[model samples]
Target: MKKAFKYRIYPNKAQQALLQVTFGCCRFVYNKTLDIRKKAYETDKTKLSKFDLIKKITPLKEEFPWLRDVPHVCLPQAVYNMDAAYQNFFKSGKGYPKFKSKHRSRKSCKFPSSHCAVLQDTSHLKLSKLGLVKYKKDREFAGVLRHIVVTQESDGRYYASCLVETGADAPEPQPVEASTTVGIDLGLKDFIVTSDGRKISNPRFYATIDRRLACLQKHEAKKTKGSKRRARIRLKINKLYVKKRNLIKNYIYYVAKTLLRESQTLVMEDLNIVGMVKNHSLAKSIQNICWGELRRVLEYKSQWSGHNLIFIDRWAPSTKTCSHCGFHNSTLTLSDRSWVCPGCGTHHDRDINAALNIKRMGLASLLPAVSGFDGRGEVGYGLDEASICTV
Candidate 1:
């Protein structure tokens, strides 16, 4: 298993200058290599191989001697990173490789520990050409260090992300407590409603800062380009963004932690957030919920903590069905918050009913395989199919 731990680092003025040089050189190499590859592919149908790119480095250094000022290890790593990016794009159908900008791109350099990257002690990191830098060691990790990525955030803070290779595979999923199963329905009105009837309010962190953010952005726009005032406003906007992100992250972690602690088996609806965000009316509120981030956090944490996380299909009629009677309400509109079931005369709260339906569907899916419920929905054990909620 591999994990990364990031900590704040304080580099001296000389080291900062050296780091800036490295950042620039690495960015230059990445952009140049990408441009060369794209042009060659377009003009001559030639894919510039990594080896071919490496072969040009000598001539490149001779033409541009300033590249020699940074650590020798960083230049080749830049080529490798670019190659990896292209490989990822081709393999995953991600966006095409794009040029990096010094002002817009993240300032980062990765150094493999085998090549002049080391930890002198718990509180210090040493890199080639750059002396031992001081960092806060608030937590300890047990593993062999593989690589370290030093990043300069937009807010002018430095961080070092140490990747460690733990000599073990990730723990396998364990059997969950059947009594602790839960289903979650995510929404904007309430952040999440559970099948068990618990609701967590949406914090709306971004909404809280929207007015100030708009003011800062407008102020930044009025300032002349390349002026000190524009730079100052940009820094202020970046800081506010950083603060907002941190707040959301902290709240997400807390919520995920609490949910995982309570439920051993958790189920959530598979939402099409990218499609949903296209609606101009609800886009801001939808983004403010941060459902994607919440889902991501729950997924990894569930795996690490031996909990089961399941996603029901996005097309499931959770919101339009009566959970009590399994009756699908075709005429139910988004505006209807509460409704009465025609089939069973049961009243349902919109979000809570949706959560209950999700839970029922999740249990149905899991139970059929585990409890010998056959294709015809018949249980071998004389028990009602609905009674065995095994998710």
Candidate 2:
């Protein structure tokens, strides 16, 4: 397995200057190589190979002497990244590569395994060009170092992401008890409502900072471009944004961890977040909720922790169906928080009822394809018993 561990690093003034140059050189190489690839494909209907772009580096450095000031390894890494971006675009049908801006783009550079080394227990990293820089190593990993990416965020904080190849393979999930199964209903009002009638209140992380963020943006807009005042305000805005992101990230991690710990089998609605965000009135609220990110966190964590994570169909009428008597209420609107089921005559809490329905559906889907089999059996054909933990 491959994993990345990131840590905050504090570089001296001279190192910062060198890093800035390295960032610029890397960005320049990426953009230049992208341009070369585009022109090559357009003219000859052929893509520029990584080796072809790499061969140009020697001449490029000789022509532009300043490129020699940064680490020689960075240029090749940039070209490799460009090749990867192009490959990803072709493979995934993603958008075409775009040129990176020095001012607006992310400042980052990758150092290959041989180019960088970490000092054990010294809390320092040594690079080919950049000398030993102090970093806060919260935890250490036992693995072969693959690569390191040094990035400067908008908040003016520098971070080092160390990628390592851990020799351990993923563990297989154990069988789960039916009593520990849970279903979660995500919402703007309450972050998560469980099938067991537990409601986790939504902590609007962005809402808390929205006013200050808006004020900063408003002031930043009024400031003249290229002025020091604009730069100062921009930094302030970025710091706030980073804070907001951190808060939400920490909250989501806590929620996911807690849920996974409590539930052996977890089920959630497969929400269409992109389509949901199209509603202008609820866009801000939906964005702040960050349902997609939470789901993503749950997905990977579940695999590692040996938990079952299931996602029900988005179009399922979880809200309309009664958990008690399986009554379908067609006229149930979004505004109706609580409703009495016509067929069941049971009052249902909208979110909780939906959660229950989702749980039932997920468990049903896990039922054996052919009857007379012992235990839960295989979760339908094409899905093996061992792979049911995967989302």
Candidate 3:
């Protein structure tokens, strides 16, 4: 069982500068290599290979002498990045890699850390050429690290992820209390509505912090791009984002723990959030819910705890179907929070109804029940009475 734990790092000021420089150089190299590969593949048919990229490193170093002091593996990593890009491009994953912006750029660097390597808890990690440096010690996990990723976010926070090998097999579970099944509905009005009748309110966190964020953005926009003042504002904006992120992460952890304590099986709607966000009206609200983040935490925590996390499809109409009477509303509107089923004449509290149906739908899909009963959890095009209740 291999697992990875990522922890935020608080490096000293000097370390921060070194990281920024290294990140910039790596980003430049990655883009350059990708560009070269793109042109080559377009002009000729040969695929860019990682080994070939390493062969070119010597000539590259001669042309860019400053790179000699940097980590040797970085060049190869850049090539690997291009190979990955080509694979993705071929698979229609995303648009080609474009020139990175100074402020709105992606920021991450990877260094090879193999299994059986010596590392310390709360001690320095040695990168090639870069000397061992102090880092903030955080909780360690139950695995031998196979890789480490150092990332600097737009907000200027650093993180180190240790990809570890726990073992080839899963460990026996510790004793726990008897558990129950839960169906969850993630939304804007409520963070989540569970089949067990849990209504976790959507904390309008960004709504609370939006003004300050807007102010910071305005200040940042006033400064010249790449100027020290712009950098300062950039840092300020990043810190605000970090704070919100931490708050959301903590809340999610707390929620997952509470739910796992009671439930063995988690039934949830597999929402197309990225697609949902495409609607201009719901974009901000969608980002605030961080539904995707919550689901990821739920999945990993369930895996760690030996619980089943079932994702229902987004096509089943968990919302439009009446949980009590099994009646379907063919034309339920978004504004119709409360609705009555024409066939069954049953009144529904939209969200609660959705939660109940989800619970029913999930059970139907995942469990074997008597006739006329289906699973309580479902996710699909709520666009057509395909709605999951807001509960």
Instruction: List candidate 1 segments past 4 Å from native.
Output: 116-122, 206-208, 276-289, 369-391
Candidate structures ordered by lDDT, highest first:
2, 1, 3
TM-score of each: 0.89, 0.89, 0.83
Clashes of each: 0, 0, 27
User: Candidate 1: lDDT of 89?
Assistant: 96
At residue 177, give the lDDT of candidate 3.
18
Each model's lDDT comes to 0.80, 0.82, 0.68
**Clashing pairs in model 1?**
none
- Please list the residue runs of candidate 3 whose C-alpha ends up more than 4 Å from where it truly belongs after superposition: 10-17, 114-118, 171-179, 224-227, 282-289, 340-347, 367-391
| Pick by TM-score: 1 or 3, better one | 1
- Tens digits of per-residue lDDT for model 2 on 301-361? 8887778888878777778877776666899888999999787577889999888777766
For the record, the alpha-carbon RMSD of candidate 2 to the native fold, in angstroms, is: 4.5
